[model samples]
Each structure stands twice: as C-alpha cells, then as structure tokens.
Target: MPNYSEKPTIIFDMDGTLLDLAYDDFIWNELLPIRYAEQHQCSLEQSKQTLFSFYQQHNHTLKWYSSRFWTSQVGVDVLAMQIEQKAKVAKREGCIELLTYLKENGYPIWLATNADYAGLQFKLEETGLRDFFDVIVSSETLGHAKEFIEFWQILASKHPFDAKNCYFIDDTEKVLNGAKLFGIEQLYSIQQPSSAKAPRETCNYPMLSALTDLIPILEAQTTEQAEEQKKYA
Candidate 1:
C-alpha cells in the first residue's frame, strides 16, 4: 500500500541496510578486539570483554560512532582496520537493484548512518555505493548518533523532508525508534543484516528480507500516478 509515486524521501542506513553487516561485525567483535589484545599485551577474550564494556558506556552516543574518539581511547587506528577489511565489504541482496529503481523513479535517496565519516568513506569506496546517494549524513558530522532525537531534528533543519512522507530502512531498532519518535510514518527493519548470521527474532516494525521485495509495490504506485497524471492532463 506504500506509494512511491509520492516521491517520498527514502533514507537508508549504510551498514546492514544497503551493505552487508558482516564486515562491521567482524571489525568490532573480532578484528578490533584482536588488535586491542595485541596493543595491550592482553589475552583476546579479556580484551574483547574490556573493549565491549568500554563501548557500552558510550553506546547510543556520538562517541559510539566517532573514530577519533575511539582511536584516542583505544590507542588503535580504527580507520586502518576498516580499510584493511575493505575486501569484506559487499552490497546486501537487492541493494543495488533497489537503489537503481529509486534513482530511476526520481525518489530522493539519502544515506543516513551512525557510522563515522572515515568508516562511511571506507564502505562507500569499497562498495562503490557513493554515487547512489543524494546526501550522506554521518553521526560524526552531526555530533549525535542516529539513535538520538537531536540527530533527526538537526537533519530536518538541514534537509527538510516531511517525516510522514519519508521511508526509512535500518537494521537497528534503536535508530528506527528514534525516527519514529521524530514522526516518520514508514519505518522498516532489515531481518538479516549479516549474511553470515541467521535472521534475528522478529521486531515490532515490519521487516524486509530483501529490498527488492518492495519493487513491485513501488512500480505499481508509479504506474498509477502516471496514469492519473495523464488523465488530468
């Protein structure tokens, strides 16, 4: 029942929405801890536990996504690790097709993410998805993570899209909840963010197994609009 012909603003979360989240999981859960262990001469398990605890303290805040902050605290180059793992970066199933469809239909596409600029750049370059976005907003630039209401307020001040006429897709429930709080009417969650992992338990919001699944509805809406326009003309 969604109407793409309304030319609604479409906001996509970078990781887990358009791109497979396995790269990020490996980086945070595996790679970063490994590097942290080596840097501090600690056991891997102990390093992971310590790093996770440290991260949780800043979770859902700007510092959660800030590479500079993490670098200063952890004494490891987060950007370097992201670049080294660039080979693992990949588009999610139907990501390109969905983006291409939206682009061709003239729907405004925005990439809004909690990723820092460095992390966003790494993924963009690796996946070659930069050209698909009209604007890319990062938590680092906004000084607030997507989970914060202030982030959406600032985003509206800058981009000025109608929340009710927008479609937002993200993997994180917290971010979706934030958008909902900001009055966005259409919110979707990705069922499976990491291809390597099984689908997570159902969430409160509607779930998308693949973005292309919405293509038919979008196409139908566009066709209906065209026909109505023709009749009026």
Candidate 2:
C-alpha cells in the first residue's frame, strides 16, 4: 500500500487519556458494582466479583453489559441519564492544551475507546470535547475490546488513515501493544500520578508525564519530514 503523507492521524484512547473517569479507583471499585448491588439486592462484594468476572470472561463479548443490562441490574435507566457525572469530577489535567495543539497543527484526531456508544458519547460531550475529534471509534462498534489487535485493524480499514504517520495515545499497555501490532508509527503512554497503580502488562514504552510534552516531539518530526521531502523534491 502506498503511504499518504498529506495529514497525520493521531488516535486517542478516551478514558484515561483525554478524560479521567477514575475507573480503577472509583467506578469499578465503588460506584458501579455498589449501584448494581443496591438495585439487585445483592451484597456489594458479590456485585464486585460479578462485575470483574463479567469483564474478565467476556472482555470481547457485547453481552457483558450494555445500558439495558445495567438498567435491569440496577433498576434504573442508566442509559437515559448521563453516566459521566463521575468523569466530570475526575478528568485529568492538560487535555485541553493537547487537543488545541493537535487541532492547530491540522492533525486529524480520532478516539478509540472501549466505552459503549452512549457512555462514550456522553463523556466526550460532558467534557465539551466532542468537536475536537474527527471520529470516535468504540469497541462496541467492533464487538470487542481494543485489547485485540484486530479491532484496530478493522478500525483502520474502515477509517483508512495513514498508519506510517499515525500515532496512538493511551493509558492501557495492552491497547498500546495492539496499536504497535496494527502498524502505528508513533505512540505515547500517558503518565498520571492517580493512574500509576493501574495494571500494565509492560511499561517499556516512552512515558509522557503530561499531554503537552507531545507537542515538541510531533512538531519536530513534522518539520524534519517536511525538510526531507523538500530536499527530495
């Protein structure tokens, strides 16, 4: 396949990268299963175990829990109400600057998240970041988590972006590995103090302490490529 160099695509993982939902410390650990337990009349411990098992065993399965499941399990219309209330409280720092820099540089930004469509859309909208991205790719759209390399492959096939010049920013090591396997040339791992304890398969990649740290590297690469192209021409 011929490489197109007109524009570089920078893909972002929504939850930990752009908005901080504090899933590990709060939602999964507290809010979610507790809510389910309360509504289902089960013990909190049981709900927690069930939630973990569901995600672990059905990582790629769409049947794990959609809004409907949560509704039935929690006896409330979770889909009708915004689920990102917690996200609003926990969104990470430096996201605005990162999005602005990328937007200014003409990078076609996109989001690939494991969030269900409604939840994903709600978070972006709640954060007021909906307009910054060209597209939002969800695992729900692919019937699997981004942990699988094929999810990214399918996304790339559908969106048809430049992999050689493409970049992926994510907090999950598995998703980063998947991006590498999918042929993304540039990748960044967000490092946040609150997220330091999250489980990662390997911490071998370059760690970014802040989102703004990416600007110089990407700008320098763009400049270097432009100079090299001019010399060739």
Candidate 3:
C-alpha cells in the first residue's frame, strides 16, 4: 500500500492501464491489415504478413506509435481508421471508479503513454477519459518511446515529480522496467491488459487484475493521512 503524507503524483499509462487494449489490438492487427489489403488489392494474409513485418522492424522505435509515419508507410488514413473504430474503445472495468476515487481524494493524476497524440485524442474522446487526467504526456510529443531512459528524463524535466513518491502503473513490463531503471520507486503491472486475452504470467513487480483492487489500499492510505493530519493539528 502507498501512503504519502505529501500526496504523491499518480502517473498512469493510457492504453492498457486505464483503457482496454482490445481496441488497439483490433486496430493494428485486424482493422489496419483489412484496410491495407483493400488499398493494395492484396489478400488479407499477404497484407497481414507485410504489415507485421513492418511492425517487427519498428517495434520499439518512435515510428511504431506515430500515426503520421504509419499513414505514409501504409498508404492509408491511420487516424481516420482509428476514428472509425472508436466505438470499440472502452474503459477497463473498475477504472472509472478508481479514477473517481483518486480525483475525489485530490491526487494529482497524470496519463503518460506511448500512444501517438492523434490516437490518444481519439481514444480519450471516445472514452471520455480526457477530463479525468491532470496532464497527459505522449511519446510523440517527446520523440521517444516509453522503453527508453531518455523518455523518463525528459518527462521529469518537463513535469517535475518525485520519482520515489510517484506511482506508475503500466501493463508492459518493458515500460515498467524503464521507469524502474529511471528510479521510480513504486511500479505496478496489469495482469490482463486486453480483456479478451488471458492473464499474463506474473511480472517482477506487483500485478493488478483490475484498478478496483487498489481501492481498499487507497482508502486505507486516506485514513492514515487523515490521522496523521489530526496528530499534527
């Protein structure tokens, strides 16, 4: 449990942390390939193979998350596709309750993600999650992916938060490892980022099956903070 007298900043990863990742998976794996196949007049299998090859080549690079870059490479309107698939976007179970609790408690929450700004905007609009965050940071804005150390350095320089006090929850181990290497004290991983997928193997850090799991811990922390304030008073 995290109990901070100073009210630590809560940094959340957007895709798998707050929102369901099924939409992203569908967009990249199914929808994009379908559109690409249609555009190039190829079989679905051929389009998937070619697109996946491109994905493998650019896996960890900034290009992987760039809508503009993919639009040029894939010769299709990537953002338009995202907008078209916006109906599939949704918040993870218990995420809304968790966000409401954090907001009511006055925790300064920030959304940090590797999603391109356009995709991020579309998801935010579809899910209505934009207003819940105090600040939103995207890798596209910094020109680096979350897996790199420089991303954290740039984020710290721009946002300025105590690494030890901040709680960063992300679904990807690589991203969590990046934050840990950058000296973030508290880290959490999501067991099932996509509800359609089975739960993943246990990670090095603590795992959350759902955001609501932390409510009890957070409520306890709130009680502790109140008691401490009373002691001082």
Candidate 4:
C-alpha cells in the first residue's frame, strides 16, 4: 500500500456518494414514520405529515442531518433505530472499485459528510469505509452543514489542504455549491444516489453515473500533467 500523497486529494460524501443512499432512505423515509406512529399512538399518515413538515422546515440545515436532533424533536431515538437497521446499509455501485483504485494509486482520500457523528460512526463501522479515508468529518463536529462555506473554512483550518487542487464528490447539489464557493477545483454529483430512487436528470456539477466513472477523469488529469511536465522539460 503505497499511498501517493502528492496526488490531488479526493473528498467524498458518505451516505449518498460512496455508500448507497437507499439505507438512509429506508431509515428516514420508510421506517421512521412507522416507528413514530407507533410511539405516538397515531396513524402512519399523521406521523408522516408531522415528520415531513419537519423535514421541509429544516432541510439542508445542520439540524436536518442529526439523528439526535430528530430524536429530541420527534420523541424517537432515531440513532438507535438506524443502528437496528444496519443490515440494510450498503456500498453504492462501484464504490469499492473506485476507492481501491484511488487507494492503490496513492490518491489521498477524505470523507466530508453531513451525517451526524453517530450516524457517520455506525455507517462507516458497518460498511468498513473508515480505513479508506485519511480524513473523516461530520457536520455535527464542524458546527456547520456542508451547505455552507463556513464548513469548508473550518475543515481547512483543522486539516490543511489545497482546495484549488482537490476534487469533491457528493450527492447533494447545495453541498457542491458550498465547496465551489470555497474554491474546490473539481466537484461532482451522483446521478443516482439511492438505489430505490430514479437517477437525477441533471446537476450543476458533472454527474458520476457510477463511482468508477471517475477513474478515466483522474487518469486524464495525470496524462495532461505529464504532458505539461514534458513540454517544460
């Protein structure tokens, strides 16, 4: 395992980028509503209405990604529920293939996820994605969601990296916009984040249909860099 630290750093989002968003979709969208109804002794419809309203109110905010925050607001231990369904957690298509390629080739890998620390911990533990990353951060730890430039600011402070020389891949458009604002040179989004959902038709940044789709992009960058070096020589 020779790691080429000089290569352009690659930052990834956890749930929706490297890992299947289907597990999260099942946890939040399908399972939580039923559990909320059971806990509150209400109809499933009522539970969904209440929860969906909360989602709309806080979507893309730091609170939106916190299991503890939801637990306190909804009277459900959301973290525990997610842990219970850890069996549903899975890696997205080509996730391991792409990561293995990067790791073997020496690209420094980092994970910047909006998932709270608890969620990040469990998912990484279950998926064994922790070892692949040199850096792992949770928005709950940063005090700002990835949708804000401040999050990138704080992250850069803690771990110095060249934003202009790095690539970031995430499923969320707002997160990509934040990284772009912070001067990240290359940003990408997933075409289909969740296995249970349809592929996204468009994104502001280039969309990766499969995780391995990034291989040729990186290879081409290396090729161009070599050609420039030869020209200078």
Top-scoring candidate (lDDT): 4
- Estimated TM-score for each candidate: 0.91, 0.82, 0.92, 0.96
Best by TM-score: 4
Cα lDDT of model 1 by residue, 1-233, tens digit: 43334688889998888989898899989999999999999999999999989888998888888888889999899888788778989899999899998899898999999998988887888788899889899978887889978999999999899997788999999999999999997899999999989998889998898888767766676688787777656
The candidate 1 region of ten consecutive residues with least summed lDDT is 1-10
Clashing pairs in 1: none
lDDT of 2 by residue, 27-100 (tens): 55667776778877999889889878766875444554366665665565666544644443355678889898
Q: Please provide, for model 4 over 177-225, each residue's C-alpha lDDT reduced to its tens digit, 9 standing for 90 to 100.
A: 9999999979999999999989999778899999999999999988877
41-97, model 3: which lDDT tens digit per residue?
999999999998999999988999999999999999998888887888889999999
Write the candidate numbers in order of decreasing TM-score: 4, 3, 1, 2
Give me the runs in candidate 2 sitting further than 4 Å from their true place: 1-5, 23-25, 60-65, 69-90, 193-202
lDDT of 2 at 170: 86
Stretch of 10 with least lDDT, candidate 2: 81-90
For candidate 2, give the lDDT: 0.73
